[model samples]
Target: MTVFILVSGVFTGAHVWEDAAARLAAAGAEVHAVALTGLGGPRDAAGAGIDLDTHIGDVLAVIDSVGVAAGREIVLVGHDYGIHPVLGAADRRAERIARIVYLDAGMPQDGVPALAAVLDQSLRARLAERAGAGGAGGLGGVEGADGELPPPARDEWQRWGSTAGVPEAALDRLTALASPQPLATLLQPLRLTGAAAAVPTTGVLCNGNGASIEMVQLRVGVGDPALQALTDPRVTFFELPTGHWPMLSCPAELAEVLLRAAAGEGHRLEPAGAAEPPVHLRPFLLDVPEVPRERAGNVDLYLPDAEGPWPAVVFVHGGPLPAEARPTPRDWPTFMGYARYAAGQGVVGVTLDHRLHDVADYERAAADVAAAVELVRADPRVDADRVALWFFSGGGPITADWLGAPPSWLRCLAATYPILAPLPNWGMVGSRFHPAAAVAEARALPIVLTRAGLEMPEIAATVEEFLAAAKDCGADVEVVDVPHGRHGFETLDPTDESREAVHHAMRSVLAHLTA
Candidate 1:
């Protein structure tokens, strides 16, 4: 028999796992759902002193009480913020833990606080700013004098995680039962002794909340060292079709998946060996002549040979790129190729490096882009009044700023395999970065969008949603479809369709710039 210990996320307690716990118990497993200190209880039960160590102690108590029996194994399951305590406990009892399951949660590193796992960008930013300035008092200020953060209102629950597929009744119950979370819990850094790395791990990705097996594979394929470690045989993945709160939305399925995870049965990601460069790092697909290059601060300019003041196309690279990504986006072959290719077609091509290293850095990235554009326009070799912006991948969201109110000098906009909407797991709705909603204001600005047919479903969905919104608003948009292409197809797929789509998109943008 296997003993299962469940830990719920912020603002809730063991009560949130009632349905899943019962299901697991019915399947002949001994299940224990831990109610961490200051959560999943009445308001008065929480106090200012309850921090992460308090929650870790709660889980440790449960583990100790549920002593190991003959032929018995223990599986620890942590959901969302619950993973902090689970990891903390497991680090101390690595030999006792048979496996650890991460349910729709980030893989937190030692010395990093749970604040990094928060999906609400604005909230995280505010709290981080406070933490940096006030030291211990900084986070306390945001949580109120009581040092406890109140549970979100019923309507605001989506800020915590995706609410898709959750029943109305369950949501109501969750809201009513929610407890205030101690502020210190999120502020306290998680300390781990390296011993827990040996424990087998299972990641339960919730696809509806933006994480999926494909996404993980995509990151790994990009040669990300952090994600590459997941290729280890000890780490496996299982995806849930429902939202973040799977226990409430699909208890039976959650139970089944939990069982499978405990048994170490799940999909394994293949290693994108370090021998060869990742596809994005590969040489550009186009064979255009190299153009004269000039660096102006963070911006790189590829100038046309026979130009006095050429119309410039500023190509913005997509990412929440790894902070440590080698060569940076401006130096990446695709961007360099696009810049040079644009110069070949009698235009100045601009590529820039922005601080979009994390999802929350969109504002900073946008500012960087704006400053870069100002610098590019001021250059004597570029025609300031005939500039176009072309965005790719995650950089697509920044287009929203220009779309809502295009400047007279902005000739056109282009996007390739872009993410037009805020991803479900980003914990954002009606955000300023949502380009799908902003497309309506781009009435006269000609827009060129390149789409990949075989793109990841999550990303493809955003493109489709944007197209639909554009159609509804009657925006002047042209679609260039690559039927046999994938996201980052310029280098990943390298098919004739990919090459033709790239050429078509560039031509369309150039025409708009010249018109």
Candidate 2:
């Protein structure tokens, strides 16, 4: 197999791909690590004139030199910002290109510029400010030789650009070799025909930094055209455990993945822990206010004072009551208090009441929750990618669909002493609220179920059976035991133990969001 690898933006050159290239060569594939113009040491007046077309020409020139022929396909790979130009080249040389692989990267939509499409509005404004402040030949006003953009600030790069697993030696080398990015490259919009669309594509996502392919899907969904281009059915998706820079952290594994893509066997990702070690949540900000909403079923928003794209949770209260007795969003004082607590802890908390006039109303509750999710995602304050569901008491089974086959956006589910099974008394026979059976359907999505030590016999037995069955099925689930507690302890019993249990469960859910 013939392969071409393009490195991410704000980097030196082909040196970043050394490990991956060497590994590919060892695997009997011919690899080309092409350096784009105006990057690395081939600096011309700090790359004042280098743009998207220049970089595209650079890859095309490499392909011409490598000499592609019929039946000898080239596997074109790009990481981060490098993906933009690679897409351009792939479209032009569609015949010789067998596959296009994007490594923790974004794809080009017809008219969107690379940077504008990738960065959120806030971040884009910041970048624009910095660029405008740059000096002559520098991006913004930050200058480098030959008019190139300057590298990121040390603190910023350390926090966001680098990862934990990379060796210190590699970090030092990267820091030394890192070059300034060119302004024109990011500002230039890509032009493409249908040729690249016709070629097979694979998106090899880097999940080491707590960002997964599912999270990316949630971030844009099928709604955003740019994200849809990379996530459509024609593209294959896989996850890598290393941070954004997999070439430096897990070269051998990365090489094997590329080889598999070349062989038409990269459709499925390697099992989560087989190729890369899994990550768990660590206690960080175990750490929040209330605001009322008038519309969307009278939902109330409890928010933190801090600016956020904060991980949010939809708190569903339980009540299988008559129409008049049923609580509206304005009611549920206990849930509202909990939502306020969540806001203080930097989470966007929503306490919305679903219809519960009859036993069968639980089915409609799911639809209500879905609507809430869409509403929360549209808010600028919430991190749509890291949202979760929290069901209390009767609300538990109502969210069965979300628990079993959750949308990509849901990070985890927390059921506080929930009524998970369809009880003989509820009078809803043949209902699909069997959480035990639904465990397998969740795949590996994280779930936290809180068990009240002192529970009614029937509910206790059902909870036990569900936990056992979930374990047997290898589901990623855990039980938070609240010994000496009764149902709704978090809200009803304000003792130290009950408070601690609620806090612990909330923290765990936050950890899952980050993970």
Candidate 3:
């Protein structure tokens, strides 16, 4: 695999991405750090003539220089100002591209210029004033200085603390190599076709600035075209804790994230674990006709050592592993762990693999869940009337059918850090995945909802709206608050908080069945 690391322009160089590039290369990926025209090295003098097209050509040239062919897949990663040119290049060569990653960068759709898409009026005016003052031909410094903007001074560095989490030494090198950005590049509009839309994309959001996907969605509704493409079904989202300059501040973490993205992993909000199942339940596999059209995997059953006619819970995983992953049973360690935990509680725990090619597959995956529920019910070992659906992150929407009019067999529904909304490419267009809609479709069945304290704004908003609607309808729902938690915190980083949340979720599931 090859990853072309595109650096932000306006005084930035390939050196800025050195750590990330090195790490990616170490992970067996062919890495190329492209320096746009007049942006790095002594070529800063030639930046006056560099336009948007010039930088676009620079990316294409680098692709050619790297000798990427049709057979080998390549991942294109763009950071900050680099998003535009990379998109332009990706538009021209989307066929050979495997995935495109926007690292805390603008996501401009066709016809929108990168700068106009991301910059607010205040930031625009600041850049303009800085560019005009600088005699270095329409290039501005970070601090809005005139004439070949110098390295960031003490105050400027302080201001960048949240955005650039690099150490002092790295920051020094950054300013030392900082060059000038071409004004034309910012003004240039990008042209693209439907081809680029087909490429799977990931947005590595840097939460250091307090920006979240929920905020991005709000911006999209108010005529901000920059985040427009992110609303698409094919684009997945991830978050990093560092500031804007993750390459310098959190290179190792960034690299690991990119590797997972390239391999079609981490699409889920959190990471899976490798914990072994409890000793009481033994794992057994039952053969079933494979579902047609890919995304069909094994169904493992965890039966308690105690007795028959036990309550059952079907565990559905999130992260919808990409097609490129060639996933095996091992890919879902977190869900398997959950199944084991449930089995340890004397319940029949089931972990299933369903088709999740994209968000639109929610309906298909739901069908699979129904099938699994039927299979579990038919088994003499499980209680036919005591079963529930347990969904996580990407699998949250699969509960739509159950939520609308639950069957007599399903005792309750349990969802943990679920994306229970019709956002982007994860669910069917008219599906009842929206919490408000699901809650409105009244049913007597009980429900358990868990919310992360440090939840992503999008999920947080959905949860609040759901709870409000549930309360208004007087639905039988239990709300569990995981204070000091995050989205998918259970799997990403196992802590006392996550453990407590899981226990609460299980408790809620049990309370309904026993009641």
Candidate 4:
């Protein structure tokens, strides 16, 4: 018999698992949902002394009460903020645990606190700043009176995770049952002795919250060491189509998934082989000759052989790329390929290194791009009056700056496989980076967009939204579609269609620049 121990995330407690627990019980598995020290009760009852260790004790107590002996196996399931305590307890009780399930939660590394896993970028930044400035034991100041962080307001619940597929009554119940979370739980780092590392693990990704098996695979394929670790044979994945709160939104499905996870039955991610280069470093599809290049600050200018004051195209690479990513975007084969290809076609191709290392660094990255453009135009070999800015991937949002107010010298704007709107999980509060909303201001400036047919659903939805907004405003936008192409198709899916799409996009941008 398998005994499943459940842990709820911040704001809720064991009660949050009632529906799922009943379903699991009916399926013949023993279920025990843990309500941590300071949660699932009145806010006043949660004392100031409650901390992460207290919650760890709470989980440990449950583990001790449910004896893992006599042919009984234990499967530990942690949801959201609950993963921190779950990991802590699992680390101590490694020998008794059969498997650990990370349900819509981040993989908490040793010495990293739960705060690092907070989904809200701005809030996380603020909290970190406060913690560094002597807030509360390096945790940060809490909004609640008794050293606890208050639960999100009803309308603002989306800040925590996506609410899609959750019924209205369930949401009301969730809000009502929400409890203040102890600040120390989020501040204190999780310590491990490497005991639980060998335990088989399962990840239940919530697709509605913008995490999926495909995204994980894509991240691993890029050679991210942290994510690459998940490719281990012992680690498996299962995706839920509902929102973050699967218990409230789809209890029966969640119960089934939990049961399968207990059985170690799920899809496995393929490890990135050491022999092959990462997707970004792969050879460019187009075999264009290398052009003469000169470095100016962080920007690289690829000059056409016959250039004497020629039109230029500034290619901006997409990111929120890992800070440790090698070769940088400027040195990546795709950017190099595009630059070289443009130079071969008689235009100066410009590529620059920007500081968009995190989602919040868009402003800084836009500044870097603007500064690079100014430097490029000042070059004697480039025509200052006719210039185009071509963006890719996550860099697409930076186009909002230019689209809202086009300069006379700016000839065209282009984006390929771009994220035109903030993803649901991004927690972007304002419309500052929303290109779809800004397209209305782009009256005469020519726009070129290249879309991949097999792009990620969330990203593709943004592109569709942008296209609709562009059409509504009658903006002069030309879309180039690659029917069977995926994101980063230039190198990842090097087919005839990909090549043609790349050429068509380049031709369109060049035409606008020369016109």
Candidate 5:
């Protein structure tokens, strides 16, 4: 297995992984220990720039190189603050990775960040008394026997960046680091809801008790259940004896566990170790879901922070079952993230549930999406000309054929792992479902149809047919197999390929919208 080792907390540098990586390599595994933008004791220009994305991209560049020669999946091990960029890297390279192993670091225990997780209950109360002095949140430490403790220097942010152990020399390395991290990583809520939930992760907790500090904090009622990274369904917990600086004390054990996980032979894997599943509190589900308001039908909308009101995209939830049959949150988070990403580049994202009629025609659902867009735009926050439409699975053809008819005011269209065959059972219906009609006013609009290996045969054929039709009518059409996801990737946990496909394609979508 290939392992990417990332240093997250305090003073980090890929140098830290030298020893651990050597051992893993001897065991026939590859490991890379990397530092984030600012914290690592490196001159910024001396190495790669320090922007979070640059760091993520740096890792991706390496993974891409190693992937060309690998046999199994890649395993990413991140420490502390490193999870963000490592995850970002994983999100963009979901296809290349087999699993993620977080050593002495993982997502927070609850709503509170990891900083809050490590501090014991009694220490927390004491810190609260000192809240006026910036408290624990400030990263300020009391003057110690070693001399004055470091105050939370605004530039030395404990918010966007963090550290656990660092020598004085590494502190000098920050002079040439890149710009500080964007606030979104901290203040922004990570919405792993619906079909877009992230890949599963394992946390190897090291510190005081065998229990993770996050778990300990939770038992004391100090955090929100959802914020805890441990709640992710793919999560498996293990304990190690050591402090937060495990690379310094227990590199061998961390490497062993990481190798085991990549080999899919971890001790507590599923039925091998029966226990309660992580209590998921996100908008999505732990099991098959039941929609509370079946008849009324609700739609979930995600807006980008940078875009106005929002340039909304409506997702027609795809399913083989009846619309009344629960579809859970559908693709809200995935669609939303893509939309918000576009919005950050200046667009909006919108998703809606459709009604399945007795006739079972899907255009009705398309019309419903069209109507939802109009309604969403009616709100001051939405922009009509900037509107885009997206769909997955069965919803794929629903929107494509729907667009065939009197095309609504969509500026662009994006379809992923779509199934595009025209059903004889569903009528021409002459509106959004009529492909011939939808292309009539197509002088300038752009259409992106993304096909993947696991895509349905008919859908691929239909998309091929649609591309010819669009080009004949003078519409812009780009068809590519960017996301190489497996069958049912829409439901399976995310992979690096999944993220790179979505993000890269989305950049195109957003750029077209703005241009």
Candidate 6:
């Protein structure tokens, strides 16, 4: 239960961390996003004159309402203006927090107002213009008292308004509203103290001179963000080459960096590591003569245990071919993170050499999955009520069809990045191997689908199709979108949460079998 709560800076919503949040989940950390009060969206009950404490209180109430996990410490991240609110949260719930990260955030001290105390004169003057009519005189510094959105400055902000390249409709909605700030929050200095500084802190600075570190530093008289934090023992820093938002421009890379910071895991850019050498392919075998073997039609199987009977989890590999041709072993030395985890959790793992099919004809492939399931059930230890399957990448299509109409041996299904062949895209016509049909048959069972969070946007449509299939089939679907993670995350050293999620999905199916 390692929780990472990310707070947004001014003029942003939880949507800001959309990319990075997904990546963190893929890397195995539990992540949540935060919206500063009066920033992302209005609190239903919030009114004007909402001071800094109210904002901090707003965020704290959310944390309390959701409730932290049982034992792990939470990580608090504050960006720009959000520093005040998180610091206040830490003051009250420090025990729940393990570390605090600031993304070029302002540091406020006791009895000090947040905005006025940190902003340089240049920023203050610029802000004065945007402050409504009544806000002109309220501003502390040098500009004449007219709080108006100057055409030029407003235009500049508008240009860089969105991180996801922004949609025109959203841009219109945001531009329609000009936010007003409370005089108290603007004038009051921050209330930082010795106690809070004692906690762990990390800073990420954008050296590209965009909005976060560079832009602010350019306006305010300060050096780079990471360098500034170096003097503080509690704070660690890193520089990313981007303007303001790294999530929009480089989600995958940034997510890796965040994951490294969280798990203390290895961090390599796949420099020489992206692809394995030739001969990375080979046949993977499961059953051993030492262990009791269950013979089923020319196939020798290894059941997890020989007690009464345990649920079977037939593992399918991608690349349509015979097991001997492009063999898929139960435990592959090259990479079997998924198998290692599922098997460790007591699932009777089965590795199959699949049957071939026309490149586009999935019905043939679907039939192969059916045959494999039948072969699996022939074993004595395979509990008909608890049997499941874990299908990898391209193998998903075959297994998806099996789940829709699998033998009694399969009680559940786990598909990773399966292709919804029923869809009309990619020149595909009405598919005979419509997974929706099998879903209808297996509607009563639990199904877990894992997909990469940062895949092509078109994948969303594919997912929608699957969701429709699940709904039509009356199946229970638990879709875990691994954020910032690429396809085939099973091969990597994912975060604990990511692995746990998969395990939980498996356990749920197993538990339901008994229930």
Scored by lDDT, the top model is 1
Off by over 4 Å in 5: 1-297, 330-333, 336-346, 357-359, 400-402, 405-409, 424-441, 487-493
TM-score of 1: 0.93
Model 3 per-residue lDDT at 19: 86
Q: By the lDDT metric, which is better: model 1 or model 4?
A: 1
Candidate 2 lDDT score at position 169? 82
Ranking by lDDT: 1, 4, 2, 3, 6, 5
Local lDDT at 202 for model 5: 70
Q: Is candidate 2 or 5 superior in lDDT?
A: 2
Clash totals, every prediction: 0, 17, 9, 0, 25, 21
What TM-score would you give candidate 2 relative to the actual structure? 0.54
Instruction: Please write out the lDDT profile of model 6 over residues 1-515, one tens digit for every residue.
Output: 56778776555567767878987887667787875555554232223556677767776776675565576667787766677778888887776667777664545667755544323334553554545434534444333212211211334442322223334443454434324344444544555555655677666654432223222221121122323333444555554554345555566766765554454332111111124421223221221223344445433455444365666666665533332432233334322444443444555656655554223445565566667777667656666667777776546556555665555545667776655443222122334455544566674666788776744333344566677877876678888777755444443435555565565655665565555
Candidate 1 local lDDT, residue 314: 96
Better of 1 and 6 by TM-score: 1
Compose the digit string of candidate 2's lDDT tens values, residues 1-515: 46555555555578888998898888777888888776765342345678888889988887777665545678888887788888889889888788898886755676666765433233444455654566222344434334445654433443333354677787777776776777677767788887777788888876554345544442232123335345445567777766667888898888888887777664433232332212111111112244533345546677777778788888887655434433343354556666777777778888776775444576677787777778888888888888988888667777568767887889998888887765433434446766766777888788988899986544675677778878788878878888988765644455777777877888898889777
The regions of model 2 sitting more than 4 angstroms off are 5-7, 42-45, 117-123, 129-147, 153-155, 159-162, 216-233, 268-515
Q: Write the per-residue lDDT of candidate 1 for residues 1-515, one digit (tens) a residue.
A: 88999999989888889999999999999999998987867654577678899999999998899777776799999999999999999998888999999999998999999988888877877777887887545666464546767788899888888887899999998998898877789889999998899999999998778788977786677666778779999999999888889999999999999999988899998887552777778888889887789997889999888947889999998878777777788998999999999999999999999998777788899999999999989988789999999999999999999999999999999999999988887866667999999999997999999999988777887898999999999999999999999888888888788899999999999999998
How well is each residue in 1-515 modelled by candidate 4, as lDDT tens digits? 88999999988888889999999999999999998987966653566778778898999998999865697889999999899999999999998999999999988989998888887778777777777777555553456445667887788788888888889998887888788887778878899889999999999988777777977786676566678779889999999987789998999999999999999999999886653787778999989997888887799988888938899999999877766767778998999999999999999999999998767789999999999999988888789999999999999999999999999999999999998987766767564888999999999999999999998876887899999999999999999999899889999889999999999999999999898
lDDT of each: 0.88, 0.67, 0.67, 0.87, 0.50, 0.53
Worst ten-residue run, lDDT, model 2? 277-286
lDDT of 4: 0.87
| Residue 234 displacement in candidate 1 (angstroms) | 0.9
Off by over 4 Å in 4: 42-45, 137-144
Q: What's the true lDDT of residue 48 in model 3?
A: 48
State residue 213's C-alpha deviation in candidate 3, in Å.
4.6
